[model samples]
Target: MFTVIEEQEQRLLEIRRALHRHPELAYQEKQTSALIGKELDRLGISYAAGLAGGTGIRAELGKGTGPCVALRADMDALPVLEETGLDFASQQSGVMHACGHDGHTAMLLGAAELLARSTVLDEIGGRAALLFQPAEEAGNGAEAMIADNCLQDVEMIFCGHIDTHHPVGHLAVDQGLICSYADPFLIEICGRGGHAARPHEAVDAVVVGASLVLNIQTMVSRMINPARPGVITVGRIAAGAVHNVIAGRAVLEGTIRSTHPDTREQIIRRMQGVVRGLEEMCRAEISFTLHRGLPAVVNDPVSCALARQAAREVVGADQVISQGFPSLGGEDFSFYQQKIPGTMIRFGAAKDPSAGPAHSGSFDFDEKVLACGSRWLATVAVYGLRYLQKS
Candidate 1:
C-alpha cells in the first residue's frame, strides 16, 4: 500500500540529505525555504514564502474547502558541530540538525508532495496547509507565524519530532500534553566591588547569586506538587571579572519547565522570591527577566484519536503507542495548537540500537522512518480533513 509513498519519499529524502549537508540556523533558512517552495511548485501545489517573521514557507492543496489541516515542519538547525560521518553530513560548522529537524522538514515536504498527488486525499474533502517555519530553535518563530495569521483557517495541525529514544518505525501518540513549557530566564545582580581580601566591603553579588541558584531548586522539590512534574536548572553563571577582586555584577541564567501553567507561575514566583530574599540578605540589588519560549505541547484528544487511526492505517495498530505522558522538553509546534487542535507525534529516529540518542551532535536517525513519518503525516491530514468534513 505504501510502495508509491516509498518511491516518492526516496526523492524527498534526497532533498532532506541536501538540507542536512548545508544546515542553516534560525531566521536564516532562505535556501531551505526556497528548496521547499520549488518542490511544492513542481508538485503543482501553490505556496507562500517569507512568512512568520522569518523564512517561513507554506503550500496549499485541494478545493473541497472543509477545514485547513496544516502540516508543519521547522526549518532551523542547532548550533552544534556535526560528528556524524555520513556522506551528506552537515558542512556548516557549529550548526547541525542534531535534533532531527532536517528529517521533520523532509517528511512534511514529502507529505505535501504525496497529498498533491493523492486522489483519495482530495476525495476526502481535503484542504491542506504545509508550513515550513524558522526560528524554532530561537523560540520566536512560532510567535512570528501566529502573528502572521498562519493558523487563521487551520482546523487541526500535526507535527512530529524524531525520537531516538524510541525504536525505529515506532510511532508514539498521546492525548493531552506531550511536552512541557520551556522558558529561559536571565538574572542580573548588582553589588559593590572590592578586593578579594576585603569580604565585608563588597556586597558580594556572586554570593547572592549562588544563594539564589541553590534556593531556586526548592521551587520544584519543595513547593510544587509532588505528583506533578517540574524542573529547574541553572545552566550558566557569569560573575566576577577577576579571581582576586570581587566584581560589582553577576549574572545567572537557566530554564524552568512544568506541565501546568499555575505550577509554572508558582515556580517563577518562588524563583523571584528566592532572588528577593538573597538581595535582602546580601544587600545586593537584582534584576530579572523571563523570556517566553514555548507553552506546553498539548495534543488535542479528538486529534489524537484520529492520529491513532491514521498511524494504524500506515503501520498497523501494534506500532501505535499511547501509554506515556509528556516530557519536560519544549516544542514550538505548541503555538499551532494555541490556535487550532493539534497532535505532535513522535517518530522513532533510532533505527539502530547501537547508535546513541539525539542531541549528541554525533546522533543519527534511522532514515527508514522517512517513509513512516511521511505517510503518517499525510494520513493524519487525510483523517483531519475527513473529520472536519463530517463535522
Candidate 2:
C-alpha cells in the first residue's frame, strides 16, 4: 500500500522544492496553477481550469458510479521573505511557502497520481476529486471554490496540513472543532485636533484610542466565561503624525477568535457594546467594522474515524494521535464541511528543533512526511468513498 507513494517520494520532494523556490501570493498563483494543470495533464486526469474565476484547479478520477470523495490542497503563499537558508529557498522576493502549502500541493498531486494508477475506484463505488485551491492565506479561496460548486455531489471530503509541533510520521485527528472562528476588525475614532500644550481644548483622540484598546481586552477576561477559550488581540495601532500636534483620528486593527458559536456571538456583542461605550464616554465619533473570516473547523465524527483508521493502517496505531489539542488558527476548509461531511488531518512534519512554526520565515519540515501524507490521503479517499456509499 505504501510502496505506491514510496516510489514517487523523490519526485514529490523535487516538486515541493521547486514550488518553495518560486512562491506566489494569494490570487496571483498563475505559475502555481499552470504547474498543477501540467501535472494533471501528464497523469491523463481531466480537470476544470481557472476555477473560482481564478487560479483554482479541480480534477476527478474514477470510472464507477459511486459516492464522490474530495481531497483539497491550498496553493497560496505568504508575503514573508525566506530565511531558512536552504538551497531551494524562495526565489520570489518577499514571498514564501511558510505555511507548508507547497508540500500540501505536492502530496495531493502524488495522491492523484497514485489513485490514477490503482484499481481502488473499481473496488470502491465512486470517484475522487482533487481540489487545488488558492488564496487560503487571504482567507476567501475556499468560499470562492464553494461558490463555484466545487462541493456539488461530493459526499465526503478530506484535507491535511503539515504541523511542526508534532514529530514526523505522527498524525493528529480531531473528532470535533479542530479550529477557531477568526474575525478581523478595524476601529476608527475621530476627535477634535488642537495644540499639544493645550490641556483641555482637544478631545484627545490618542487618549481615547489607548483607553479603548485596554477596555476591549476585557471582552475575553471579564465579559466571557473564562472556561471557554477565546482571544482578542490588537495586532496594529496607528494614530499621531508629529510630536507637537495632537492627532484628530486614530485607527485600531485586531482579530477575535473563539471555538464555540455562542461564545463567538457573545464576544461580538460585547465588542460592539465596548465601542459604543467608548464613543459615549470619550465624546468621539467611532465606527467599528468586522469582517468575518473563516468559521471554526468542526470534524464529522464518522469521517474523522475513517481518516484515523486510514492513518493507523499507513503509520501504525501508535503514530495516530486522536487526542491532540486543537488550534486557534482558522482554516477555510471549514467551508466545505458546512455543505458535506469533511475532516482535515494534521500531518507531522517537524524534522528537528531548528524547524520554526508555520507562517514563520524559517519554517521548514521533514520531507519524509510527504510520502506518508500522500499515502494517507489516498487511503482515506478510498475508505471515505466506501463509507459514504454505505451510509
Candidate 3:
C-alpha cells in the first residue's frame, strides 16, 4: 500500500456518490454503517462496530502507542425529497442526504484510507481514530456516543461540516464558539371550550395562545440583554379545528439557542416565566417539554492553531482565514469538544455557485472539494498525532 493512498481523490468522490445513491435517515443507517465497516476491514484497520452511538463505527490505524487524535464524520441523512437530478441521486424516497453528510462520510473514509496506507503513520506515528457516527442531524448522536465511551482514548478530536455559504476549498471557524446550543421547547395551553358567539362563556385557548406568542416576543426583546445574542422562533402552532367552535387547547412549539450556556438557561427560564404569567392571566393550564439537542461547540485555541497550520499546508496561507462570527446552528460534535480539546471546522461543499443555500430541497455541494476535504483531514490527523506526541 502506498502512503497518501495514491487514488484517494477518486475514492472520495466515488464513495460520496455511492452513499448518495443509498441515503438513509437518522438512527437507521444499517446499510451505510455496514458499507463503511467493510471498507475499514479491507484497509486492515482494527475497528469496532455498533459502539458509542446508533450504528457508529470506529477504526484505529497504527500501533496503540501515543495519544489518539480523532476525526469524526456523521453518517445520517435528512428527511427531504431529492430533487438534485444527479445521476447518483438518492434511491430512498422521502429521505435524502440534503445536509451534505454523505460528503462528510466520504471525506473521513478517504482520510482513513490514506492513513491506513501511509508507512509514516504506521511506523513513526501514533494512532488516528476515524469515527463514523450516525444521527448527527438529530443532535443527540454525539452525546449518545460519548455516553458509551467513544472518547475514552481520544486526547483531541476534530470534526467538520460542509458549508454551502463558504467558497469551495475554504475553511472558517472562530477560536471558540463555532456553533450554538440548540434546545427545543413546547408550550401547551388549556382552557374552557364553548360556543364561539358567547364571548363571556368561554376562555378560548386559541386567543390565549396568540397572546402567549406576543408575550414571548416581548420577553425576548425586553428581558434578554440587547448586546447578547439569542433566538426565539416559533416553528409550529396548533389550536382549534372547526371555525365556529372555541378550542379548549392550543400548543406552541419552538426552539431557544445562544452562544453561552448561562445565556441559554436564562432565556429559557424567562420564556417559561413569561408563558406561566400569560396562562395565569388567561386562567388556562400550561405545559412545557424540552429536548436538549446540543450544547455550544467551542474550538480549542491550540487546536485552532494546529488546524490553520495543517490547512495552510494543503491550501495557501491566504486561503485560511479566521472567522469572527459564530453560527447559531447546533452540532452534536459539541459533545466531543466538551471532554477532548477538540476543534470543529467548516469546509466548502456547495454544488452550484448559484445555489440558494444548504438544508433546502435543492441542497448540493461541489464534488471537487472532496479531494481537498480528504487531504486536509488526513494531514491534520497525522500532524495532530505528531503534535500530541511531542507534548
Candidate 4:
C-alpha cells in the first residue's frame, strides 16, 4: 500500500497544489466538491455528492458484507490572504488553505485511489466510506454531515491532520481527551446614556464591560480545577460611539476552552455568577450568552491502538508517538465521535524549525508527508474493519 501511495506521490502533490490555488471557505466549496466527485468517478467508486448543503461528498469502496469504517478529510479553507510566496499560492482572494486542508484532501483522495485498486475490502468483507467534508473551519461540517447520514453504518472512523510541530515522517496518536471543548461567548452591558461630564448621571457601560472581561478571566484560573486545562480569552470588544458622551451599550466577545464536561459546566455557572454580580454592582443590565462549539475530541482506546499500529506500519515504530498534552484547540471531528468510535492522527509536516503554524497565511508544509498520511488512512480503515468484524 505504501509503495502504491509513493508511486502516486507526485499526483497527490499536484492535487494538493491545485486545491491550494483555488481555495474555498466553509459551505461554498463548489469547485472543491466537484473536483472530488470527478476523481471518485474516475476511480470507478460509487459516491453521493451534494451532501451537507451541497458541498460534502460521500464515496464508498469495498463489499458491504461486514462492519463499515469511515475515513474523513475536511475540504474547506481559511479566510486568510496568502502570504506564502510559493508559485501555487491561493488564487482566491482573502481565502487560503492555511491549515493544510488541501494536503488532507489530497492524501484522502490518494487513499481512495489505493483502496479502489486493492483487494483489502474483499478480504475483510467490509466497506470504507470516504467523507469529503466541508465547513470544518466553521466548526459544523461534521454535524451537517451526520444529519445527512454520513455515518449511517459506520462502526468506526479515522482521520488525520498536518502538524508542523513535529518533523516529517512522525505520527502523533493519543488515546483520550486529545482536544478541548471550545465555546464562544458574548456579553452585552447595557447602561443609561448621559453627559460624560456628569459624574453621577450616567452608568458607564465601558467600565462595566471591562470589569466583566477581567472577571471572566478568573473563571478559568480561580474557578476551574487546577489540574484540568481551561482558558478564557477575550478577543473582541465593541463599546461606545463618541468620546465625549457616555455610551449606553458595550459588547464583549470571547471564547472558552475546557477539557472536561464538569469543568465546562462549572466555568459557565461561575461566569453567570460573575455577570450577576457585575450587574448588581454597576447598576447595569448585563446579558451573557455562550455559543456552544465543538466538544473535546476523546479517542477510544481501541481505535487509538489500531491507529498507532497503522502508523507504525506506515512510518516506523519509533516514529509513532503519543501526543504529549491535550490541545486547547477544538475539532468538529468530536461530533462524529459522539455517535461512534473515531481516532484523529496528526502527521508531522514540518520542513524545519521555522515552519509556519496552521491558520496563518504564511503556513506551508512539507509535501513528503502526503504519502505517509494516505498510507496510514488506508491501513487504519482496513485494520479497523477487521477488528470490528472480529469483535
**Top TM-score hit:** 2
Per-residue CA lDDT of model 4 for 1-391, tens digit only, reads 4455345898898899999999999999999998888888889999999999999999999876789999999999998989888899999889999999999999999999989888889988999999999999899999999999999889999999999888889999999999999999999999988888994899999899889888877666777788888898888999888889998899889888999899888888899899999999999999999999989999999999999999998888999987788999899999999999999989988876455689887899999988889888999998899899999
Per-residue lDDT of candidate 3, residues 1-391 (tens digit) = 2233447667777889999999988888888999898888888888888874559888888885777999999999988888888888888888889888999999888888777767767655588888888889888888777877777688989877888777787876558887889898888888988899995799899999888788878877877786667887888999998999999989999888788777788888887787788778988898877777688888888888888777888777877765557888888898888788988888866556555466766778888777777878888887788788889
Candidate 3 structure lDDT: 0.82
TM-score of 4: 0.96
Best by lDDT: 4
Give per-residue CA lDDT, model 1, range 139-255, as digits (tens).
879888888877778889888888887777789989898899999999999999999999888888888888887788766788899677899878899988779998889998888
Better of 1 and 4 by TM-score: 4
Between candidates 3 and 4, the TM-score winner: 4
Task: Report, for every candidate in turn, its global Cα lDDT versus the true structure.
Answer: 0.84, 0.89, 0.82, 0.91
Worst 10 residues of 4 by lDDT: 1-10
Q: What is the lDDT of residue 263 in candidate 2?
A: 89
Q: Clashing pairs in model 1?
A: none
Give the CA lDDT, 0 to 100, for residue 195 in model 2: 95
Model 4 regions more than 4 Å off: 4-7
RMSD of 2: 1.5
The runs of at least 3 residues in candidate 1 whose Cα sits more than 4 Å from the true structure, single-residue gaps closed, are: 1-6, 351-356
Provide TM-scores for the models. Answer: 0.95, 0.96, 0.94, 0.96
Residue 379, candidate 1: Cα error in Å is: 0.6
C-alpha RMSD values across all candidates: 1.8, 1.5, 2.2, 1.6
